[model samples]
Target: MIYSPPRQANFFMIFSHGNGCDIGTMDTFMKILSDELNTHILIFEYPSYGLCQGSVDINKTTVNNHAERAYSFVHETLHWPTDKILMYGHSIGTGPACHIASTKPIGGLILQSPYTSIQNVITGLIGFPGYLFGNSYWNNLETMKYINCPTLFIHGERDGLIPSEHSKTLYNSLGHIENKQIILLPDDDHNSISYTMSSSCVKSFLKQFFPPSNQLLPEINIDPEFRVPPETIQTSSSIFSYNPFTSLFNLSTVSINATQSVYNSMFSNQYNNQ
Candidate 1:
């Protein structure tokens, strides 16, 4: 899914969604980000999620391959400049976002509700040896060592699933990057970190890279339509509700699967040959 603001965009944000929701579920959120930050957003689905075709496999390698392909499609085919592209990942999506940021050239990176690694998350939550269950998959701590670009980490201080310490650990690991920041939302949780909750912080972070034009002043308030009353905000049980591992703890159901090409034919038909 792609969301382009009415005016020309200075940057492109390649977004990787969490394990639970696919592109279809993130349409509104993507639009909100694009409008608020004044950037074009290209958010893709993992294989077997949403309209993408394939069996469900939520490992680091598979998702990184998908994310790199999306970056190539944006840069090589769609012709977005490498330095003007930013990567944003949420939850499990942060794995691939970190992978691409470490390997590819991009202006910035944003990680939301991120974990240092799947292993660390498992270890922190259940008080067991993480290697016994998660291994080293999606290790953002190791990946952040290679990332030199401006990076922002966002997490809910009240996040019960992954915990806020995950983002703090990742931030501390990126000590070499001068332009790094971490924002912890006091009122948010795993599922409550919506645009309304972090819009100002995100906009402030983006301005350091893409300064607002005269026509687009900074500090503009979020649209009323997008704002949710604090009273209406409710924390969910978990954002990993669709993950298979959660089912082992009786938290949720099995992952979703589907049959289709790993790369959507739309991109091949329209851009691959171009």
Candidate 2:
């Protein structure tokens, strides 16, 4: 996935996924996200996918690949500083998110529909004991000890495959107060969350953490007062229309907006690309 954060972006987010989702799923998400966050979003596909794809040898090893890809995308491609990115994940993606959070000084972490561990999920689904499953994601009781970033966990209360209890257990283990939040929405099942509640929780989480890197990224100026893109608004915008993340830091457009929906459609199309 390639993300261009208006060339002035500093705070970016990157992720990996569960078993079946592809870049296309991630693309739709980024489009919705771009409505609020004007930052870069990257989603990576694991080795185990389409018929010809290679097998994922180790579940835990995924953390390493995610970190490497995110780092490369941030530091090399986006030309942003290392300490400015946030880490986000969904379901199986949490393994890698927790791994990177353990090692990096992330801006924040947003985890949606995460599993406690691979063994826990497998056991829940297959009725097989953890000892019987050779491929264990053993993440349940493990990653919490290492996650150092401000964390937000969102889960579906009625999830059948991976219960919301997994999120509760991790949220309880947090060492601090301001650093954690666990939210479980009502009537939300695993596969259908996006149509119900995931988007709002995502906005809230991003609203909270998006400020940390405001200084590092350029803010777009949409001050109705300034009628034009002041070249001076580099690194921070003089306007406020494009991102609330600007005001979140306690912060856009005309030629880009005179066409309104056309620009939105173009931007939406661009943001959703993997």
Question: Which candidate number would show the highest TM-score if scored against the true structure?
Answer: 1
Tell me the number of clashing residue pairs for each predicted model. Answer: 1, 15
The candidate 1 region of ten consecutive residues with least summed lDDT is 253-262
Expressed as tens digits, the lDDT of each residue in 42-114 for candidate 2 is 6655543322134443335644675577667565665655556677777766777777777666677778888
Please give the lDDT score at residue 108 for candidate 2. Answer: 75
- Regions of model 1 farther than 4 Å from truth: 55-58, 134-136, 212-274
TM-score between model 1 and native: 0.77
- TM-scores for every predicted model: 0.77, 0.69
lDDT of each: 0.73, 0.60
| Model 2 misplaced stretches (Cα beyond 4 Å) | 4-10, 50-59, 134-140, 209-214, 218-274
Winning model by lDDT = 1
